[model samples]
Target: MTSLTLTRGATDTRTARATGRRTAWVPTLVLILGALYCLVPIAWVVIAATKSRSELFSTFTFAPGSGLLDNLHDLSTYRDGIYWQWMANSAFYAGLGALLSATVSAAGGYALGRFAFRGREFVFKLMLAGVLVPGIVLAVPQYLLMSELDLADSYWSMLLPSILSPYGVYLMRVYASAAVPAELLEAARMDGAGEFRIFTRIAVPMMMPGLITVFLFQFVGIWNNFLLPYVMLADDTKFPLTLGLYTLLAQGASQPALYTLVIMGCLLAVLPLIGLFLVIQRFWSLDLLSGSIKS
Candidate 1:
């Protein structure tokens, strides 16, 4: 009887261990599949970018070619290097727009989070509604409004619309409520710190992580924004990289050589966002770490 009981216990233990391993593999397999799904397209772009016009069509999807430098040269010389102009325009739109948006979001969020005033909840709820409404839904109306202001086809057309991100404001508000303490504001007030000083000095520092998050979101959104820029700008010189790359693709239908340039352009365009993420990730991690340490 004792030997039978021990044997049964050992069998059950082995069964449990085998079940655990199987369950663990389910998520592991899913994650591996997800990674491959995302990476395959990027890999294809990198490989295609290396190919020349002839090689792009002839080579295997994963195989690399030797025309990267030629493709770069062609892209640079195309339309007297308007691609660089598009890049610069995209950088400007994203950089300045994100900075301004983050600033506005910080101010607006801090006010909504910390202050008590008439219809404050109403205003916040209204902003939340704005967040729910897709940007595409607003694009045509924004274009028409820009036209009314005589700002259409101008940089301001892009910058102005981007400056007020409802989502950014919402993010900051949530972050501030959690991150900034009421006691700190009271202490600052007791020290006779003005509202502006308290916000700029105390609130902003406390909310750096959220601010960085909002900045990155807005930066990427503005950089990749297509419909807004397409609707707003007519001048190709003022076009952002998205619209510009689109034009390249459109022309590629007729001029097959432009296909290689377009692929190379996509490869180049991805570099800045990747670099930004890597650089900002360090600061973001440090800020979170410092916040944890302080707490």
Candidate 2:
């Protein structure tokens, strides 16, 4: 009887270990499948960019060609390198808008999160409603409003409106509430530190990770933004990389030679964001993404 009981216990432990291994594999399998789905397109683009104009449609799907550098050169020389200018413009708008948006979100959210002002909750909810305001619906009205102010088809047309992101404000507020402690504010108050000073000094540091989150979201949005700039800017010189590549592709429909250039340009356009993510991910507090990171 003793021998039989020991044998059963050993079998139970083996079953538990096997069950754990199976559970671990479920997520691993899902992740590998997801990765394959995403990477297939990216790999296709890389291989597509390498092909020559005739090879784009005629060659095997994954076959390589030797025209990558030549295509890049052709794109560079197109319209005296207007594409590069578009890239610089995109960098300026996205970088500046993201920085300012992060600043505004950090301040606005910290105020709403920390202060006990009347109507604070109401104001926050109202601002969050802006998130639901569809981008397409708002873009037309925003364009008209900018035109009324004589700001349409210019840098301000793109820069000013892009900076006020409702989602960034919401994110900052949530992070500020969770990451910042009330007692710290009270201590700052006891020191007779001005409200803004305390916020800028004590609160901002604690909220740095959240601010990075706001910055990245706004940056990527502005970088990828097409409709706002499309409606706002008519001049090719002022267009962002998205608009430029689109125009290239639009022309590609008529001129197959432009296809390689568009694909190469698309590849170039993605590099900055990819580099930014790779560099910043280590510093980013992904814990804040789910909200309420433990103090």
Candidate 3:
């Protein structure tokens, strides 16, 4: 038996991709269903925020009601609009802490990626080990240290400790190793650029995509975190949205009026991250995020 076939690069590529897609449908559907499951709560919160307290429980659960403005007004007037204060506090801590953590991670990761120094492996391994230690363990000691320095129950206490992220460091290390070529660093050195200059001019730009991811990761982690801020902060005025919401929910256990407010607050808390992602997407280099960890 004999077979005759004709193929071209463009046609072969198209056919091969088509065949692959035919095999990928099951996994793709599963992923889409998982995404929908995750997004359903978010949808419910949005719809719930639009409803009045009575509508929230009485009306069809997902039906939109006419209470959006009233909810907003109540939230705005609640405790003299302390909810907005909590929101601003979260933004400050997450934004500033993420920026600093990204910078620190970029510096530390770039150095380890491009250069070998005494005890480099030991230090990197120790840092990787730190990532295994849960945030809970650090919360108590970090609180105690902040108290020792008279920084406890303060914004600085939250902002300062949040800036050191082991995961951000690891992400940057992976990103820098893959995205940055050692040749470029050597070329920059050959061009008489100082280490700092090479880093600022060359390495930073190349690693920006990874850095933005690191920043966003850290920002979201800090934004969602409850325990550390809960332990460190005492003043309602200094509380981030997450901690503030926890307090609000705790109060709601005794006073049911706060239930509506908590739902609306949850709706409001999600907007900043969504808005940030949209804004940062245009500037972020996502190509750097694709790579592997060494064994």
Candidate 4:
């Protein structure tokens, strides 16, 4: 009877393992389908950007064309290279705005996460509310407010509003609460360190992963944003890449030759973001892992 029971248990275990292996394929297949869905458009754009004006319509959708260099040259030469200026403006806005936003998020998050004050919850709730407010709802009011300050149609209008991000604050707060130890802060306080010093020296370094994530989020949002910049600036020269690309697409409707330029411009726009991810992934992963372990 004992020998028969032992054989039965081994058979049951083997059956369970087989079932688990089969179930795993379900999620793997779903993930693969999701990845293909997302990648399809990007793949289409890359292939479309390679075609000449004539070949763009003539060739099969996925077929490679021979005008990649020619398209790039045309885009570079378009409107006296104004596209380059738009690219510069995008880089400037995203770079500066995200840096400022990250700084503000770190400070605000640290305070909200660590310090207890009279209006702490109230302030945190208010910021949380700001996150619920849509950008479109505020666009007109923001424009009017900027106009009142005589800053409309200028870089200030764009930069000032982009600096304060409620979501960034929220993310930072959560990260700080987890990544930073209360014991460490208390010990620092006992050693005569000021709040600001404790934050800068201890909290910020430990919270680097969260901060970088916030910066990257802000950067991508600012860089890809069309509505805010469209409403804020009246001058074409100050347009970011998104706005510039829209303008290019509009012109391409009348002059089909500009289609190739628009496609090439889009390809160029995508490269920086891809490169940023590739370069930062190593640091981002290590820091995130270390932070998770510490927490």
Best by lDDT: 1
Per residue, candidate 3 scores C-alpha lDDT tens digits across 268-287 of 99999899888788665344
Off by over 4 Å in 3: 4-23, 285-295
Assess the local accuracy of residue 141 in candidate 1 as a C-alpha lDDT between 0 and 100. 97
- The candidate with the higher lDDT, 3 or 4, is 4
Provide TM-scores for the models: 0.94, 0.91, 0.89, 0.95
lDDT of 2 by residue, 1-295 (tens): 9999999999999999999998998999999999999988888888888888888878667877888888889989999999899999999999999999999999899998988899998999998899889788988999999999999989999999978888888988998998899998998899899998999998998888888888888889999999999899998899999998999889978888888899888888888999989866866745455345444
TM-score of 4: 0.95
Pairs with backbone N, CA or C atoms under 3 Å apart (clashes), candidate 4? none
lDDT of 1 by residue, 122-202 (tens): 999999999999999999999999999999999999999999999999999998999999999999999999999999999
Superposed model 2: Cα runs more than 4 Å off? 1-13, 285-295
Residue-wise lDDT of candidate 4 within 58-105, one digit each (tens)? 766798888999998888888889999999999999999999999999
- The best candidate by TM-score is 4
Model 4 is weakest, by summed lDDT over 10 consecutive residues, at: 286-295
Q: How close is candidate 3 to the true structure, as a TM-score?
A: 0.89
